[model samples]
Target chain A: MKVKTVAEYVASGEKPEILFWVGCAGSFDARAKKVSIAFAKILSSVGISFAILGNEESCTGDPARRAGNEFLFQMSAIQNIETLNSYEVQKIVTTCPHCFNTLKNEYPKIGGKYEVLHHTQLIQSLIEEGKLKIEGGAFAGKRVTYHDSCYLGRVNGEYEAPRAILNELDATFIEMDENKTRGLCCGAGGAQMFKEDEPGDKRINVQRVEQAMKTQPDVIAANCPFCITMLMDGLKAKEKQDDVMVCDISELIVQSNGL
Target chain B: MTIAQIIFILLTIAVFTVAFRQFKRVVDNIKLGKSEDIAGDSVQRWQNVALVAFGQKKMFKRFIPAILHFFIYAAFLMTQVELIEIFIDGFFGVHRFFADKLGVLYTMIIGFIEILSVLAFVSTLVFLWRRNILKVPRFIKPEMNGWPKLDGNLILYGEILLLIGIFSMNGADVVLQKLDPAHYPDTGTLPVSSWLGPALFGGLGEGALHMVERFGWWLHILVVFGFILYLPYSKHLHIFFAFPNVYFSKLKSRGEMENMPEIMNEVKSMMGLIEDTGDMSDDIPEFGSRDIRDLSWKTILEAYTCTECGRCTSECPANITGKKLSPRKIMMDIRDRAEEVGTKIRSGNPEYIAEDKKEAGATLTIDNFDDGKSLFDYITNEELYACTTCNACVEACPVMISPVEPILEMRRYDILTNSQGPSDWLPMFNSMENGGAVWQLPDERGAWTKEIEA
Candidate 1:
């Protein structure tokens, strides 16, 4: 996996079709990093000429804004906007819904306008174009339930894209009782991922995982890295990690195609 | 006019003057908040008012209570026509004024009102039971312990008294009509009261019946006047504010928060979109709300419009999880604080009065209070930080209030102005400033990719 930075692409005088906005979790979190790789592999196999910002990429200031530090959010958003504008980037794809949402919805107001797509949307488009093929190599008959990240499903109204991609894998697609627009938070949104959980009778992620377990899923598919981290911790809490695998939608595609 | 009629007119004028003055004060206090225009999209705003306020769509989420509330709400409006008639009789001393002209229509209308009164009375009892006996969890939160609890019961009791007065007066009127058909006239209809009213007062002499009717009539009118005056100070203010509040609600996507334009302007200047006027360096206006005055006037209107239904708090994830942040309490506090500041200003407190005179045309902020108490004085940092910004409260609010907006604004003040927040937020803040991420270093970003390749 030879990753090309925007700076490299610029120096070579060649522009990639899309800039991959690998977010903080995708870049740093141990488990979320796997999703970044899986998504990158999917793009590579499909022959999409997308380049990541590499070291030049900074956080999209989502956490800062959510944490209520408006000044910090502005500082970060400005730097990222300047870098993206300098690259003359037109389209962006990311595996993190927080980054996806901030870039797609929040950036335009600050003058950094670009066509942003969540990885699931990109995967769905690739499948539609027949550029990527999945034969359901291992997960053909497995019960897979997809958890809707708050930003993607409720906020963005993008319930169809991830589910559509999962359907293409020929898996036994089950639905959580709380799914799509009515989906519950995985307890990591609003910068809760970086901080300690608030005192409560039960952790929200645990409750969400219980809802996922009700479907008796063999694979719990997630679209956001934050959701993956929270749901995986939830599975671990239930001691069901060995029995049920928690994976990203892109990871499922790579496994299905044996890419 | 007789002396009694002259005195009655003066009293009516006095009550009207006091109630109107209080109402005007509330309007002025709401105007004290900084304005944000919510006057576009007339069709959609009207639709929101129709659905949320009149349709009571959100109220129906709880079926039993919704039914009970609907009876009371519908009866309250229908009874206004009856109240108008009472007002005419009070001033002009013309009993059953519409009876002869309206004929059957008047009879049918009175019959309907009688049935609605009985229904309203029964529903009030049920509501009282829910509040006092059943003790529904939503109604019994810690904040509802003292005045809020008594305030709710007081409104219900007031409604009961008004219903009783109407029934008793109708019963007496029926007896008087039978005794003197020429003077009283065979006008109004009373189905339930016709039987029940006579059963209680049939044994009374004609003179005693007249006295009972006079007492009931006077009590009903006086209670109605008192209820009007109490409304501006009570949570029941929702009766008047709900329609306008829902009409002016944010029609944008529920998940989208409004970006601070001042902050955006600073970023634009930094990006060289406009000339750097050095406004960013001069004074550096606070980034978020610190008090009710800092909030938009529409948000203040939301506070005034809250019915204290606890729907928002019940649906809030943080409150459900034992966090201190109750959305219902947030709205209530805003209203309470605004009232407090407004009262202090009207009292001509030397400090605030001097400051107001100095500022002249300037916008009111937390400093206008002069009490040194801010939103932070009451709202804890733990509560503000606990919110997930999920918009569940906004979705559940019957009046279309957005509690998260104020919570977020207070948080902005804490972070940008006060330079304080949760301890865990420090690293994330530093990371965002240095590396554009929550991580401390940019080099570590690609570590995950390398591990997967290996």
Candidate 2:
């Protein structure tokens, strides 16, 4: 399997419709790597002309900026923007809400601007446009509940895209106690994933998992790589890992389509 | 002029002077903050004011409290009609001047206010019960320990006093009208006080009823004056600040933190993207917020606007999970420190010195008057680090205050200026700076792509 690079597309004097932004988690984290493969497979199945930055891709500096290091954030942002500008990347899609949010919202101020979309949004549009067909397949009657990633749902105000795909899958889509605007975080945001949790009675991820557990769903659907990792770790802590599966919306769609 | 009119004139002057002085203090305190450009977008800002403030849209999210709040709010507005008449009668030394002039229209207005007064009274009782008896979790948070707890109760008590005055005044007037139709004109019956008034004061003689009416009249106006004087020191100040605060709220997405131009320019220059103009100055740029002066004026305004509702804290994930971070506490701390620092700055400044201090010829030095205190003295490092920056607090705020903004600023000061942060963050920062990711495997960044099919 060969994933084409933006450089290769540029050398051939062609442009990709969308640049697949594989964030650190999607590229390196073992579990999130499966989401990268799933989303890439969907793009290829839909016959969409997309290319990855490959080695050219770097951290979007979201974690550093959130951690209060603006110098490091701009350093990574400026370097990535130069590469993006040189390649004349017009549009981008990512499996990580942190990357999508930073590139779409924070990049314009620092001279990096693009039509960025989350993978869920892209898949939703692809389904609507008849370019992609999703079948019930493996998850027909399985109960699914969505854990809204703060960056995608509340920050970017895109609560519908992931839910829309779930609705298309014919799964028994249930909602958690706190969903949408009031959705709880998986305790992985704000650079919490990289650092140890502050001394508290319980982790935020465990609390959020408890909320998801109340839904009693077979699948806990998430849109961000960070959220997926956090939810899985939460399930393990609750000893519900065997019963409940933590998966990305892309993975759910890939399984539903049997891609 | 009559003696009563003369006294009322003096009282009016005193009330206005006190209110003006206290409000001016708040304005001066807010001006101590650093200025930022949050201007333009007048249309959108006004829409926010109308929808969030005037419409009370967010309050309705919690059904029971919103309904109770609506009753009190409606009563407050309706009471203003009767207030205008009371003040006019005081100024002119006339009893029920509008009753004779406006005729039936005046009676109808008084009836409406009477009904609302009863509603307000009931609502205030329920609010008190919720705070004291039920002990709502939000009201009992550690932040509401002392002055905040007493302030919450005091506001409800004030409302009760106002209601009592309204009922007694109307009740005594109803009896006086029956006894002496000449001095007390027949304005028709008020809705609630008509029956309740006669039931309580009907047995009194004409002279006693007259005395009771005057006493009630004086009590209502005096309590109103007291509220005006006390508002600046109480959380009830939100009654005035919430409108302007919502109007000036940040219009960006909740997740978008303000970009730092100082850091951006320096980083660009360091990268050779921008020219090093050799414009170095004796004063080095400060990195982030250290004191009230280091924060933007909007944040200071938000601090004053906070009513200590604790919606932000209750929704805060860290607070829920038993971490020390409470967004409500952050706003309260900012307000408390602002008041402390603002007072010291004012008493020391020559231009804005108080009249009492001016008389002493106190030419005191203003510099270093903070006694080496800053925001960190109030907000601890443990609480600051506990924030996940999830924007739940930001979303929960009805008046649109962003607690995360100040937390970010303090964190920036901790890392950039003081170079102090959690030891755990050091490895992550190093990974990002050296390897361009938050992990050590830089070369394998694209290894996942190998699993993708063409």
For each candidate, the DockQ is: 0.48, 0.75
lDDT of 1 at A123: 91
The residue-by-residue lDDT of candidate 1 on B1-454, one tens digit each, is 6675676789899989999999998887788687787767889988888888999998887789899999899889988988888888778877878878788998888888888889999999999999999999889998788989999999999999998899888888888888978867675657886787779888889899988888888888888988998999899999999998988898776555678877877777877877776767877577788877788988889999988889888867677667777889888888888888888767765566335445655444434456667677767777788888777777678788999889888888888888887888898888777766787864666566566466
lDDT of residue A251 for candidate 2: 89
Candidate 2, which segments miss by more than 4 Å at Cα?
A: B278-281, B349-370
Error of 1 at B169 (Å): 3.4
Interface RMSD of each: 2.2, 1.2
Q: Considering only the true interface residues, what is the Cα RMSD of candidate 2 after superposition?
A: 1.2
User: How high is the lDDT of residue B404 in model 1?
Assistant: 86
Q: What's the distance in Å from true for residue B107, model 2? A: 2.8
- Residue pairs clashing in model 1 are A59-B436
Residue ranges of candidate 1 with Cα displaced over 4 Å: A1-19, A38-51, A87-91, A119-147, A157-182, A198-202, A210-221, A249-259, B2-8, B171-179, B183-191, B194-212, B267-274, B351-369, B441-454
Cα error of candidate 1 at position B277, Å? 1.6
